[model samples]
Target: MRRRAWLHVAVLAALVAAATPFTAGAAASAAGRSSTSASPTLMAPVTRTFTFNGTPQSYTVPAGAVVTITADGAGGATINCTYTGKGGTGGRVVTTLPATSAPTTYTLTVGGSGGKGCTPSHSGGAGGYNGGGRGGPVLVDGTGFDGGGGGGASSVAANGQLLVVAAGGGGSGGVVLGGPPTGNGGDGGPDGTAGTAGGARPNAGVGGGGGGGGSTS
Candidate 1:
């Protein structure tokens, strides 16, 4: 009886010793898994703004990043000299950009406001930055009436490819002696329309229409 009890106790001890390593290994693996799951990698969000500077600007972004782009074209210039027509407003655009797998660089072209003052008689206004058109001039009773300049277009590009564009507004035109009410300026892109011409009066210079804004597809 004594021998049998000793044999039973030795077997039980051996079993416990064999199971100890497996239980400890399982507990260690579970702890490692918990630690790994507690911490994760995250990406930060980015935001930027662009404005007219008469030159192209550059921006860089991370790979697989989502981007939102908004652009606005410049407004046409007005003539403070006389009771001339008012300039048109610029166009606005908002869009979402596609994600790129590699780090990307984008080029920005901001629109410039139209120039003021042409000069002398029958002298037209200068074009705005980017793609704005020139303004029309007039002469009435041998007196010169200078015209206002057109606004410029804004655009964005990626890898030398054009992504989007917002068109500019048309400039104000001059008046005629008995001309049609005052001349009206053209609206900006999307609706890109031309300005109205001045009315005809004997011995009075006839005014020309302002150029239309550029359009995008």
Candidate 2:
């Protein structure tokens, strides 16, 4: 009985000795693998705005990202020819981008407002134009009136693709005559073309109509 007890004690000690190295090594391995950083949490949505027309911008969409864009047209300058040129239109767009294996860079642009101005007299220098500003006629030689300019359109681009567009406003008409006539300015549509200028009656005075605004496709 005493010999058997001694054998059992020796066997138990050998087994514990063998298991001790493995248990210590596993604990050390687990400790080494642990991270210092905390778990990830949700973040708020992102947004950006463009006030000028036709300005180019760039951004990247991350995993599980949603995007929205809004574009507004500039108002046409008020004038007193026979009529005034109208203001430009505004628009909005929304889209979702899928996750990419790697971060993808996207090209973006926002449209600007057209310029507005007039000639000095029956004959004068050229006025400014761009984006939404359509060229109006420059009356000269005869005793006629001046004219107004049209507004410009806007555009939104994502990943080099056109997503949305807001149309431009129209220009007003110009007229000069012998009798007294009302001079009114043209206002732009919400998302459409502009109105024509107030014209002369029965071949009375000298003047021309304003141009229409642009659109997105």
Candidate 3:
């Protein structure tokens, strides 16, 4: 089986407003009262990154500030026999969350890579964190052929509302006896569709399912 490169990244940036104190009166007295001026100050932007550990992560943003969120899905696993069928790559998604009157908390879920199957097994491996699909398994006579697992999806939410989602890739299919394996797995959802797994074999191992896509609403 051929080797594949896996890369997952997430970056967030937020801009907020600030105020600066004014010196004593800058203008001469007007009609027995001193005049003063006030201006809004722009604060520096804040950037952050999150890592995945089979659990959800959280971040807080200041009130009255706009926040941008970006997420990447994980890749699927592959199966190797005489011939190698490579897994699909992960997908990416970007969206923004509007500012609120009060400070807001957002939750992020990173995608996980699919399980692998280099040897024959009774069942396929489990899917990664998030929404990755599981690989297919086959039973022939007294032996079982296992398929690779699917990748997981990456997601972001705030106030219980889903803000953005990135789809994961599909897993590779099982191999046939004494020969090459089936076709390779499908790519992740480009726009918002789910990932697709490779072809399945009759009375043999089946391909894994792809991860589901996310929303930007």
Measured by lDDT, the strongest candidate is: 3
Model 1, range 40-98, lDDT digits (tens) per residue? 23354556677777798887765666667766676666655545566666676667776
> Model 3 — which ten-residue stretch has the worst lDDT?
2-11
Task: List candidate 1 stretches off by more than 4 Å.
Answer: 1-41, 139-142, 177-181, 191-204, 214-217
Q: Write the per-residue lDDT of candidate 3 for residues 15-76, one digit (tens) a residue.
A: 44445555665344444666455644444666777766888888776666677766667777
For candidate 3, the TM-score is 0.75
- After superposition on all CA atoms, what RMSD does each candidate show versus the true structure? 22.9, 22.7, 4.8
Model 2, position 28, has a per-residue lDDT of: 60
Candidate 2, residues 131-190, lDDT tens digits: the string is 444434444445454444444445545556765454444444444544344233344343
Candidate 2: how large is its RMSD?
22.7
Residue 121's lDDT within candidate 1 is 52
Off by over 4 Å in 3: 1-40, 141-144, 203-217
Native-referenced Cα lDDT, model 1: 0.56
Which candidate tops TM-score? 3
Report lDDT per candidate: 0.56, 0.39, 0.61
